[model samples]
Target: MDKFLKMTGFATSIISWYNINKRDLPWRQNASPYHVWISEIILQQTQVKQGLDYYNRFISLFPDVVSLANASQQDVLLAWQGLGYYSRARNLHAAAHQIVERYNGVMPDTYAELINLSGIGPYTAAAIASIAFGEPHAVVDGNVFRLLARCFSVELPIDTGEGKRFFTNLANELLDSTNPGDFNQAMMELGALVCTPANPDCAICPLRTMCNSYRLGNPFSFPVKSRKTTKRDRYFYYFVHESDKQLAITRREKGDIWQGLWELLLIESDKRLSENQIVRQLSESLNMAPLAVSHVVEMRHLLTHQNIFASLHKVKMPEKFNLVTFKDKIVVYTGRENLTDYPLPKLIEKLLAQYFDLPPKVL
Candidate 1:
């Protein structure tokens, strides 16, 4: 078959399959520019099933660009709690302000204008442009990359700049210009459902007959990556200090993980500290020995590039000890019952639930 004819067949097969097999999602119910933009941002490092509730809650809270822009950053982060990679939430808030100021509270229609917004990169820009605005821009996310790499048997590493360009051009060439919205969604849906990373359902794949990797019987090996991520481990010692029914908490400072989130008094160390070492550090920092030092529990928290080994401890202060003495170190002294009002990192939240008997609220 001629290349053009084959491409047309590929697109037609995908769109037809999508029309019948596509999951009924809230975002698909209304492909408005604002809805698509929010869904795309939420789904970047999140699965559809997990992101569904967050999307519903976020839309309910903010509803539109103006509402998001007017809200405080803390409120946005609070709404986005438990969804890791907090930078995405921060960027979304920033972009909302940008949209309100520059575009008069309307999402930009063109790919160029959309991409210029904070955190709206090529894939997101293409998604919003094509799906929401009917622009002929192909989105190349993880799903699309896997589908194209295997179908064409491309060996270029998907992590490299050159490989990304090659796939972007190929996707655009194969894009159905007349129906770019469904075409892009069809490609993504096919990859997500059929042409998966492992154990692909090739028998029902729309492009199985023409897939080069399928013919070679090595479908899993086509989407190549040249780089491997190495996660660095750090130890965190979180001291839960309580005095007169008030708990000491601090907001994580800028230039660190979990920035803008609240946590117990923290003593981070390059290496894990012994119990004695923890006591000594705490005594020195607070200028008073803890009345009782009880080891609570340890948990390992994983991030994209970091592995945190966190230890939670309870440090009972003396009866007459004043929390005001450590005002510089402790940002807030809130009643034990009011900790839920402050947004906390997942690690801290888990610690509270497992050891402190404070249940996390359903977001």
Candidate 2:
């Protein structure tokens, strides 16, 4: 009885702290299933501040599952242009279709049912199930793992499977069944606001009194994780073929970054490429040498494990190949005013806004 009461008090403390201290996010406002679903997925790879506008854009465009399901994949990808981890967008779209077809436009209310969706992993499944449905499923995200490990002074490496299972069970035990939504959000809020990665403010932390790591004078020591990512550098050469008032672009397809998004004619290489080699390569690939080739600025885009260093080469092609069908499922075309209609990678999008003076997308 004493042990149970302590666990109960732990959950209550988190819930009380969360109710007053949580940030006023758009997704957490209404707490609707669809709203929570969209916000959580966007935030999976992106931070709250970075993902806010994207979530608003998605909500404005798709609004709900039926709208997202009815829209073409290209449209969905275009809306998610800058957010990156494009597979998440693709999976969201696929999951929407699945929900419409299988679940009759209703989101699955349980972790078991939600986990069967395309992009709904165990973490996401728990978040949605607990917060939306009040299912009391413990969400063991990075924030939760950090808080639990430090609060209890557990030394288990959180990156390992054994550590994950241990912490997951711990989280489940600490869930406040009466108010799972508030408890889960409060725990995440504690990590995001108080127990940060560096120099955690132990003085104002609500759980500091009982925190074992704080007692030990090293609040940052717990939640030890293994595996550091090694980034590989890639070189991309994009040729901007312009004729009269039109620009040429190709739809990236299959096993590539920005999959399903439209980009300028791309020629990738393994190493630092010379301008002459770029010109020669473009000439050979296009089957007609560009009238003029001017090198633009080099741009760097960082992914989870890849760092792309790309250079823009604006080529002037004659107004002949206005539309080129290179192969099945890939369409290359020229556009002047409707370029933004199709989604583009951030690097390409920024270049168009800079070089071509195309206006940025308004919120």
lDDT for each residue of candidate 2 in 31-90, tens digit (9 for 90 to 100): 888899999899888889999999999999999899999999989998898888899999
Shift of residue 4 alpha carbon in model 2, Å: 11
List runs of model 1 lying over 4 Å from the truth.
1-6, 324-330
Candidates' TM-scores?
0.95, 0.92
Alpha-carbon deviation at 8 in model 2, angstroms: 3.6
Candidate 2 global TM-score: 0.92
Identify the leading candidate in terms of TM-score: 1
Q: Write the per-residue lDDT of candidate 1 for residues 179-222, one digit (tens) a residue.
A: 99999999989988999887799999988888888799999787
* Candidate 2 residue-wise lDDT at 45: 83
What total of clashing residue pairs does each candidate reach? 0, 0
lDDT of 1: 0.88
